[model samples]
Target chain A: MPDLGISVLFKGKNLPRLLGGLWAALRISLISVVISFPLGILLGALMTLKNPFVKAAMRIYLEFIRIMPQMVLLFLFYFGTTRAFGWDLTGETASVIVFVLWGTAEMSDLVRGCLISFPAHQYETSEALGLGKAQLYRYIIIPQAVRRLIPLSVNLVTRMIKTTSLILMIGVVEILKVAQQIIEANRTASPNAAFGVYLAVFFLYFIACWPISMLAQYLERKWG
Target chain B: MDHVTKRFGNHTVLDDISLTVHRGEVIVVIGPSGCGKSTLLRCINALEKIQGGEIKLGNEKIEYGSKRLPSLRQKIGMVFQNYELFPHLTVLGNIQLAPVKVQKRNLAEVQAEAIGWLDRVGLEGRENSYPRELSGGQKQRVAIVRALCMHPEILLFDEVTAALDPEMVREVLDVMLALAAQGRTMLIVTHEMRFARAAADRILFLDGGKIMEDSDPETFFTHPQTERARRFLSTFQFDNIKKL
Candidate 1:
């Protein structure tokens, strides 16, 4: 009502540009999540192995990922590895790779926690019931662990969506980058374009993440 | 099970124990806490690795890490103190899971057999009920029915009634008594002296990792052979209850 510059979002081609930018961010995170989810589950099952060597190796990998920041990982893949290994990697490709690595580590740890925390009697009961190792995991362990994993996994997806904002630093033309472009281009026409653009971006992120959180809550209430 | 020796680190839980359970024999093992009664049942089921013995079910030796272990386990059903029913599965699912999946039996046939066993244990019409929906006694009966559904050559019950409420104990014990009367071979570990005395064909009184007295229930309960067994049975006697 007080001329808050909300009109910039409805200006020519601006809303569509922001929509395209939101799609870009979503595409990267979705691709990363799709690749990493199964890989994380598999790696998590491996981490629960009783073999000391496998346990130690997975521990080291988990520690390395947790200790290093995701930005450093992105730079390592995008800038450092390209120069050092002489392998050509596009910014989007590099961002996907880095996100996959980080996502896998985080997701696997989540999976491992879900798996190990299962009541020990489940295994013993399955064994006593003559379930083979494979059958036990397939029938008993996974079915139960999945209920706990789903809500936590939804949270992970939301985190990945937000973290895609960091990819703008590496020249990925995602939502934030597109917002900057609009704000710069509209600097003369709309004096308060930055405020409107960023406000729209905030709504965009909220829209992306809110439904997922609601879905998690709904699932928790239903299954819990 | 012969010359079965089980040790955890340097502590020998079952020391140089040899025993045989004939077809349709009901052997009840009772002792003080940590006296290895549960361990004895576990060893026969190959749930525990025995350091020095061979457990033969019929002709096949039940050895640790055997390729045949899974098949061997299928023939031996073990129930625990806690009724470890799979929470995700319904009563019928828990009972039918092993038979249909591991045994690769027809699902319809397995389901019918599971429901039949459920009815025997007074859990009819509970096929769709999850473990949490049932009372403690109902859960234990379901556990027994779950084991019974496997049609094992023998059943090993480790204190199946120990965790139940006073009223709940009878329902589970009644199921076991029914099984025994039907000539099903079983090895039971329990703290319920009355149920032990009622159900045991032969009692193996264990102490300090040894069978201090192995004799008929009448002899073991009323005329215990060893000083340790006499002292053991005395604890169960409520001499003052007669006055009340």
Candidate 2:
């Protein structure tokens, strides 16, 4: 067999370091998802306001976030804002901030879609039943909306996990960054190691996101 | 109740409609589809904005311009044809929602009241069932009790039995008739002539957004005043009305 790069990966004690990087990426994604879920719900609800000024402001924010790519968002938060505002932010902290911003917008859009998809008669019924605003939301609106939200939210979590790889671009040393460094260091001696290393990275991502995908499918089947 | 007029962009839905419902009166509003019977009931609860009129519920003036409509709405309970129960909540939860959230009643008090209403409607055993799980008649009954838990001064039923199967219609109507016997003020929009004759104190026939005939149920059904009332009453062949 051609000199397998597997031995190379293990020989230099690089495996554990790669594992650590994977863990770091997972951690950042988890924190961002947790923060963004509720923030997304709040923003999504605010987007439905009847006030013209509030609606206009939320529309502008949603449109801006949708137009800008997440990479640009990361760079803006990590480098641009740090330099402009003169606030010291670690790479991990900045990655979380960027991911949350992106995730929140995405999740908010999902919530808005879910809320508006409900039959209009639901609101009329609540009004006829003498339900006040708080009662309407707590008893009627949110429960129905949440049923549709769960599957979409699981899909978002998977997206957040995969997108966490972008954090390595800003020097967070996540799994992909570690893989690159390993491949580069072994390039001259074993020129063919890049493909195998990328394959490993792909498997790692699949392992991380596969269960989330299953969860989304399960919720859709169960709730739909 | 006073003169109430409602317009939807230039289309008039209710025009110079004036009627008074005494305490414990059951007034049944019968009209063709799109004749604004539902709109008139919505106006009493201030759900629909009336362009040129006011509704006085007791001493309080309910107007389209007033912001205290929610407070007024609290005093009036409404039931829809579709039995608009909150799908997320259990029957008990539906009944207790307004009491706990809007009225700020204690949780135990709300639960007890909800249980009482459910029992009254013969839904005591199905308190935990969701709207999707209940039959249409049961859902409408729950909707009724949900409104009654708030102790509204007047109850509005907008074709409440119209959506039910023929067999299930009597169950809901029975509960409503029982409520009427308790002297609850009611304004019902219905196509059921028999229900009007059996339960209503007065019957108002609406046509083209105007009150074509308004009188006691006996006279309104037997001696319809205008040609419009006569034509409208003639369309329904009630088994009880023999050549009248």
Candidate 3:
């Protein structure tokens, strides 16, 4: 029933700040994904091997990271690393570092699962066709794996984008932080300003993520 | 091969198998399910490594842990029981893949050759279809031509028709016969005794990982040397008698 913050949003420099916050969120996500994907895929491929030492070492790292809470990881990198490692770490740097680690661990498992998910017969058949290990993966195994990998990895990437909202807790001034600031700034001017600001943040996230989620679903149906 | 051996941990899947496959000959291997029939065929291309002894394919004498396997494998093509067509490739894509990728042949030439093979096997119209879109017999036929496209010296068929419908088995065996009629060297592990009799120059009866009997299909089918061979072929004999 009250006037929404559209007038306020369009009237001054507020909208640019909101756009900047979205840019921050996207930048953190893109950087983390770009760095993590290849490392994760390599780690995942290594995990598929039968070597005892490699398996044990990677399993320990994967389990340690997997069970630890993401927020705990954030805090550990932001606060604990400063104390324990004697390092100067900013909120944005820590967020990027923590997200990169988390994304690598998560994406590696997805790659490993999809890599090994093909029927064992495919491997033997490829070998019988005189395909080397590299050629086998490039020609036969990887193409099918890409079908399975894309849907699941896209979901993980989108989840990482949403989880970037947690970076605001460490004070990165992402979209959620920007919304909070707008709500506080208009607390008296528009008593219902919190609702409008939060709603905008919700729509911003949906706009960013809905297409990827739909892509995952479409890929699953087509590939399965 | 002289004394080719394959072991899985302590269990010897192939206990010192020794046999020779002549060029342009169809040697059909027949035995009970766990008698290492498939394993012996797999060892020819070194798909399953031999723990001991040697395999001579063409001029290469393959030993344990030979480095020449990948190149040597180009001389040997295999068709699996499950018809492992590259599920991601279209029928023509599956057929042309090895010729283009492994053989380093021109893609257009390989594609045209693949189309010809597909037509020969009555799969011409299905070139653009995926593996999942084909029937079991059609898939097996495509699998065979995919191997044939590489122009290998020998073709190893590991129960290639085992996973088909009763009606579909004959369709695949007919294609195998066509390959055999062309004087192609073939080592087939199969239970289809009729096809074995119809197409094989020699029949190798394997049992307990040993070549129990290696004789002409006419001799082995009519007068098996070992009791195991007799028992194995008696079922085929019974089926023939039932037809009578």
Candidate 4:
């Protein structure tokens, strides 16, 4: 076997850049998740409105998001929009915007599923209790719906993190992108670096997502 | 209310059903299952849409189409058979939710009132317990208090004891009797004939989605006007009657 570049694992000089790349990836997912959650909830609630026109509009938007792939959506935002509008946009900013849009659509669908899955008698009880719309949501509807949403939202967070890898395609230089650059630069000197670097990348993703996966499992066990 | 007709497709669930409930009266609706008794109760609070009818609560017509339905619902409290308490909230939080959010009462005042209601229902100490933590009877009691905290002018019960264990039924019935004794106007859908006799001022026997008989509990139970009411009474077990 060829000499492996295993020493790269202990190179202190590369530590800061790796950590910085990891932080950037996390920040992109974190801010997008925060912005998406509330926006998704509001839009999901609006989708249930009695008005036919509004409901139709919401349905169209939801279907469009569901049918299209996220990679295409990211490309549309990062490349298509820039080309169409002649705008100057950085890769990180474009990635954040695209991820938030994608996350919002997925989260809203999760919220909608939660809201509609509640037993019909729940709304009847709310009506019977003399609860107004605000009270119905604050008390009966939201409380019950949120319990169901929690596990699903945690699952969505993991998806969002994994999908952040797609940002590397748009030149955001996230962890996978950094790993790719390092491996390519060292391929001539140490061809074995490819396997070790990719393996490290795999561990990085597992480390980032494992806790959220566990959280989803914990919530399901506790609530379901 | 006058000339209320509710239909589902070709079937009429409540056909021109008309009745007047005076202030401070207790009307117990007893019927075979699927006789529209629940639907009628639901109509009073606009939980079910009335295809063609008018419901007047305190001189104001209840409008199913109006955006003001929420406000109108606030005056009518409903207790469900399933005791649909918010599973995520504590017993006290369930009661205080509507009071604080809809009524916009002060949090302290709502909490005090919730505690008072819980005490009345014999659940004063279980305020912090979630619905899942409570027994079926306790959950129903909390549901009742949650409705009562809205301070509605009328209370509607849809088979409140139907879902309880036989042994747990009395605790909930006692709470209802206490509320009735306090002169709360109530409309109840129940299979408990004894409760109808002891607590209800009038009994309305429903069949095929229409009121088959309506009279004082003594007269209605002793001398049912319709054959359907008699058939229904025949199925009631002797042991159930003794318990009542």
Candidate 5:
């Protein structure tokens, strides 16, 4: 109502730049989800193995990921490796790598939870029915696990999207980074540009994540 | 199974149990709770590994935790106390899954066989019903049909009717009796004394992880040899029913 900086978004090219930045964040997360989902399922299955060594190793790896912060992981893959290993990794590539690693760990834990939720009799029944290991998983375990997994996985996508904001620290120029640039460019013309830009960014993130949350809720209601 | 000893941790669950089941004979194992009756059936099906000794199906020894266990299990179908039909699958799907997917049989042939078994169990129109949709009796019958569809050489039923409602027990027991009449080789563990007398060709009375008596159903039920068996049978109160 009174110079609340709402005029900043209507300015030339600012909205488009914010939308482009949103796309960048979405892009990194989408690629990460695409790559990590299958890998996570495989890792999840391995985590459930009865072998002490494999189980211990997977537990260590999972705990390592869970304990370490995602930002530190980004710096390790992005700056630390690029300098130490002498390999050229773009910010987007590094973001994808970090996101994939984090997503796979979280998603695998989700998958492992779903897998272990089945009663012991399910395994006994499948084995008694003569299902081979592969057939047992394919017919008995996977079908049921996938149903339990989907809603959680869709929620993982939203988390991944939101977490991509962290990539802005490594200069990825994602939505939050763009919002900062917008606020800086009009620092004097619109004295309250920061509030307006951040509000728009908030709406952008909510818009991106809201539908996915709805989808997860819908699946949980329908299948659960 | 010969000199089969199954130990859980430091405690022995089945201690030096030796037994042989002849072809087409229904051997019902009856005992008090925690007497290892169900464990005996589980060991025969190789669901639980024995600490000592071997079990032979015909001439081949059933190996524990081997790659061939699945193949070995195919010939020995075991039903549980609770009907463990996969909740995710329909009745027809549950029946046809192992035969079609594991056996690599034709789907149409397996489905037709499954439907036939379902019909034989008096579950003619419920092929598409999920396990959750069924009553305890109906689920047990479906579980029986699921086992029967595999065409196993023998069946091991571990207290198959124990979890059913009082009214539902007869229907499942009827299915088992029908299977016994058709000369199916079965190892049944149950507390249903009347059913044991009717369906068992031989009764093995177990106590404290050992077979205390092995005789025909009439002899074991009417004139149990051991004091433990006599005590076990007395707990059933079939004699007291007539007195009442």
Candidate 6:
């Protein structure tokens, strides 16, 4: 109502810095997803195994991920590891590592659910057809699981991207971090700049997330 | 199979049962729904373990705990009630998958044989269709031919026609009837009384985890030996056909 202060966002270094921040956010999301997806799939499948000890280990790992907050996990990876292991991790490295761990745990849980929900008849049919463990997964189990896994994992990726906003707290200049810098620099010159900058950041997130949710819906309709 | 017994945890699903099936004999296993009818076929193929007994299919005695079950199961074909075809694969692919993958047979040979089997089941033009695209009757026929392509010593069918629509039932039965005419040794678990009457050399009526009666079609239908068989057969709509 007072003054939107939309022009203040693009006045100088602010807009490009925000774009760079967006790139940083996407990069971390990509690296973490690419690394974590496969590991999560393996760990997830392993979690459903008949071995008691393996199940116990997976339970502990999944519980640790579930109970710990992402920011707390980031701090642990960044500062805690530096103190404990003496491995000085960069802010970006720590963010990537934290996201990878979080993504793996979430993706693994999704895959475990996908794997376990397969009808018992699926296993019976494959076994009855004389398929071995490898053939069972390669032919019967995995193909069926993937139909369900795609939509859910896409949703997870969008969530991981959104959650990457938390990475700014660990000193990575992601979108939210850049937005804070822009608002702080214009605090006196345009008191209304805070609202406009925040609005842009929110739209950026919406642009990124909407397509993913739409894809998830498309897959649900197409595959289900 | 001699003195074959099966148990789940402490509960015995199949109790002290013995069966001797001759080569080229068609045996139909019939019972109430929860009476371990399917488990017997599962046990025969070593898909299930027997608590205490031995099963000898020809010269190779089945080890209850052996890891080489796929090789054993390869020699024995089975079709399920659900028609569990790989939804991603087309009819030809489903039919040819095991022969090419498991047996390591020539792809060309398996493909031709699979096409030939599809032709036999009247699904020739539907070869490229996925399971989801086919009718229940077509899927069941494909499931049958998929097993037949393996060319096992004996084929086991577990309520294969039970899941089909009433209108679709005859098409699948016709396929089984032809298989019986060809004298393939088979163990069938089904509720199709007419099929048992028409195709079975012997009918085994099971109850409470044991064989209540094992008699030829003429004897079993006309005058069931046991009270259990009588009660089971009484539920059938074939009172008019119960004559030698």
The candidate maximizing DockQ is 1
In the range B165-211, model 2's lDDT, one tens digit per residue, is: 99899999999889888889999999888988999988889988999
Ranking by TM-score: 1, 3, 6, 5, 2, 4
Measured as a fraction from 0 to 1, the native contacts recovered by model 4 come to: 0.79
Candidate 6 residue spans exceeding 4 A from truth = A1-3, A76-88, A210-223, B237-244
TM-score of chain A of each: 0.95, 0.91, 0.93, 0.92, 0.94, 0.95
Which stretch of 10 consecutive residues in model 5 chain A shows the poorest summed lDDT?
A1-10
Cα deviation of A13, candidate 6, in Å:
3.2
lDDT of 4 at B146: 85
> TM-scores for all candidates?
0.93, 0.83, 0.92, 0.83, 0.89, 0.90
DockQ per candidate: 0.73, 0.45, 0.69, 0.54, 0.67, 0.68
Error in Å for residue B120 of model 4: 4.1
Range of the 10 consecutive residues with the lowest summed lDDT in candidate 4 chain A: A7-16
Q: Higher-DockQ candidate among 1 and 3?
A: 1
lDDT against the true structure, per candidate, is 0.90, 0.85, 0.86, 0.84, 0.90, 0.89
Q: Candidate 1, residues A82-191: lDDT per residue as tens digits?
A: 88999788889998998888889899999999999988888888988889899998999888899989999999999999999999988899999999998888888887
Candidate 4 docking band: medium
Residue A61 in model 2: lDDT:
78
Candidate 5 Cα deviation (angstroms), residue A150: 2.1
The weakest ten consecutive residues by lDDT in model 6 chain B span B235-244
Error of 1 at B239 (Å): 4.1
Interface RMSD per candidate (angstroms): 0.7, 1.7, 1.0, 1.9, 0.9, 1.1
Q: What RMSD does model 2 have? A: 4.4
Residues A29-136, candidate 4, lDDT per residue (tens digit)?
A: 999999989999988877777889988887887788778887898788889888899877788888888778778888878887778888888777766655666767
The reply for model 5, stretches above 4 Å from the true place, is: A2-4, A50-54, A75-90, A192-196, B66-68, B238-244
Considering just the first chain, candidate 1 attains a TM-score of 0.95
Per residue, candidate 2 scores C-alpha lDDT tens digits across A197-216 of: 77777888898899889988
